[model samples]
Target: MSEFTNPGFEARFTLAQAETTPPEVLAKLAIDTHAKIRRAVALNPSTPIKSLLRLGKEFPNEIIENPIFFLLLLEDPESQFVRLSLARSTTTDEAKLIQLFEENDPDIRCAIAQNPNAPLSLLVRFVQESYQRYDDGSGTTEKVNRILRGFVQNPDTVASILEELAYLSDPELTQAVLQHPNVSETAIAIIQAMRGQRGIPSAILDQLVNHQHHYVRYVILAHPDLAPEHLLKLAEDTELYWDLLDRRETLPTLVIDRIAEKTFQILMSPAPALHAAEMIVLWIARHRNTSIALLQAFASNQPDYLYQHWGEQQFQNFRAAVARNSSTPTFVLRKLSRDLKAEVRDTAKTALRSRKLSES
Candidate 1:
């Protein structure tokens, strides 16, 4: 009962919890009779490496959860023990997980993928790497697939990540994602639709037509067999409009019209348009399928304010893009041939000559 035999346990615990406590004191407390006090020392950010190593044996989880543990890893990044411990711990913070992932150790990355707390961004990266490996017939295909399977099995995996995994077209991974309880109905429908040799069925297309998920709608839009009506319906979503304009596949004439109409409206609005809107207009001008009428509109359409605000170089760039479009009519090209910008005038004259040569 004496003070030496039984120090005030609560006071000792308080001392163990203080950041200002000396490292030597923490090292002593690391082996204190009270388990809770030792645990506190283990969790303390200020815990010295020697004491932490000892406590890690007794409380490995606590040691890995400590902020000092991450700092230790930073100092000794090649330490297998620290790297594996941090990678395997669900309590590891995103910053530490990012660092561990960069080590590019296959085993470490696999552990991070399996960790439920891994950030979605990291999970997406794993999926992309795995897809590349799978495509190239690389020797690490099996290991990367293991990483991807861990990603799909992780409870934190979202529908977007699942969609990305499904796109890998790996039969095993796709099946696992489809069967996963976390997969949404929208994701399931899209996955099933994508697997078919035939185009999206009307019934499923109807269900997904208004789906809120952008990836699902993007998949639907990318399907070569998608009907023109569905394509136009999806086009109404302003969020997808930018992506729609960038599609490499020839879009329906009506869809192109919709894009042209919307771009004009946004440019003509009283408020200033976003730089993204201008990019969309440029894409429309460059689209090979753009109708003559829309090309004519773009050829002549110049907002004085846009020219003034965007500066002469950018304005000339838009005209140059229009002049480069093969779909631009002869009359529009002739007009562009006289453009003040040398680049636009040269581009327009070249296109006009090409058209005449083809006709001859």
Candidate 2:
């Protein structure tokens, strides 16, 4: 037989690739002199974790791509070695990254933030979580800062995400973003111009709001000391409306009315609105801080056509959310108790009952 058809090589390759091969045999094959056989063992789903680890230094890519490696992660979710390897792997899927993110281990999340394969939505979520953790005093400032820095330094980080981070106004992170190769010159100029200003002057803020780039306007809107009039002005810009609604702790009653009106208009419009817009309306209805007037408005505004198009159950679900709001007025609860939908009526009744018990 020719050297190319060597039986020993073929036999080793078969054993390395076979799922039914014993772990000990795979472990032995992991060190095979032939690179192909060793690669096959690394790629084999049935390869023992110990053998995979042994082969990891030599064949890191093959080991990371192996299904068994992810299984090992599932088996030991806290294993730093496994989590870091998967987090740093460019081949790691978005779904897996998201799952790893849910673990809320800061280091793992930081790794994912910096990973090129991480989805944009997940990166946005990481930024939001980092901000929340920092605000709530739940996370150490050092760790939160590190996570933010990781997102800033990631090559895949987009302008929108950079905009959100810029809103934080962290000097160090701003510097990192300025230096990032992926960041545009315009963005760098904007950041440079805004840098070291203790509080943005009204004139400067006005100029920023009208600047061609939405990112410049976003930075102005996110300013810690942004004036109420400026906020109201920015709210008129539909592009920034959702961000304003999501980021602000308190909004003027007029702004809230505008949001409510827009929501109803979209639902009634001939064309479908983005699902995200509808979710914002839902969030407004369910938030405890939502104006009592708006909750009552949502509870009482039962348009027949809305029920017809949105489905009676779906329409009732929105009313039910309003009923669940702690700030919902008792009169509104009484009104909802008579709602045609049982869910709406039941939720309103429960809230009313809970109130009476609390008073007693």
Candidate 3:
């Protein structure tokens, strides 16, 4: 028979949430008719391994998504499936992760290496394994290479691993390592030197600019030795411009000027929806070196188009933003200072005072 006679979902859910719920009852509730009850039981720390394992199989996503449950499932010896699921989970611990890596199965190691939480130890091991089995590069070697590629792509892979991978004689592997977000400045210098010796073409620079990995592109932008020409090139690339805007403060004056020119056009364009215009304005207003003319023009013309395009709250926010802009023209500030809403008026007055003090 069932543990609770015709129990409602609420009662089972409440029982599952109780820490003191007996192991037997927890086990029974894990298999309860309602998924909500099972969800609560999967979260409970005191739930027995058997019950948790059962939940892992029956409701794999629930077990995989919860760090607490996934870590416990990793420790279960009876279910390789459950353990493999933990290996794939982001929250799996380092010790179980190391154990998973040590196994002979390439698929298991690859799965672990792909996990964002794969610790440095696993990454180091994966890198070391990549160099081994150099015999004509058969099945295991190919799989290991794939695992190494996954490590290069994983954001959490350590900088040290990336630096070490930069020295590989294999050009493709070296290129992949360079594309990693964690690749250090020193490693980049070494790779550039190597590229010079190897006669690698300048087309690689264009490829790096368009790298699918945003962080990799960011690393290229932030490279200390990056040339003004390259920075300008990246700034002009439509795909990389937004990323350029994100780092606008630290960018060279020339690069920032170029970006501002493009962004101003986007802000002035009537074809793109008002939301896009507002986003550009926000970027311009928030960033350094925004043109005074741009701010004043937006402050003046935005209200008419903005009110028509924005909802009531959004329009209010736009007005408040205009009030806060120090670059907003004095006439616009004075107009906002007398606005009907007290909040908008107060913000304008404060900005006006600050602007006057700075001018003095």
In TM-score terms, which candidate is top?
Answer: 1
- TM-score of every model versus the real structure: 0.49, 0.43, 0.38
Which of 1 and 2 is ahead in TM-score?
Answer: 1
Over the stretch 1-360, how does candidate 3's per-residue lDDT look in tens digits?
365555677878887888877777889898887788888887776678678766753454566665555465567653665666667766678888888777756667767766767787777666656545432243246666666666677676778888656644467777877888788875675567445443334554554555443434554665544557778877765445666667444656577567656654554567643335455545655444555554554454453544455545655555677677555678878887887778878998998899889889
Better of 2 and 3 by TM-score: 2
Which lDDT tens digits does candidate 2 get at residues 154-211? 7867786876565455778888887776776545644654553444456656656665
Task: Flag clash pairs in model 1.
Answer: none
Query: Model 3 — which ten-residue stretch has the worst lDDT?
Result: 131-140
Comparison by lDDT, 1 against 2, better one:
1
Model number with the top lDDT: 1
Pairwise lDDT winner, candidates 2 and 3: 2
Query: Could you tell me the TM-score of candidate 3?
Result: 0.38
Tell me the TM-score of model 2: 0.43
- Each model's lDDT: 0.74, 0.72, 0.64
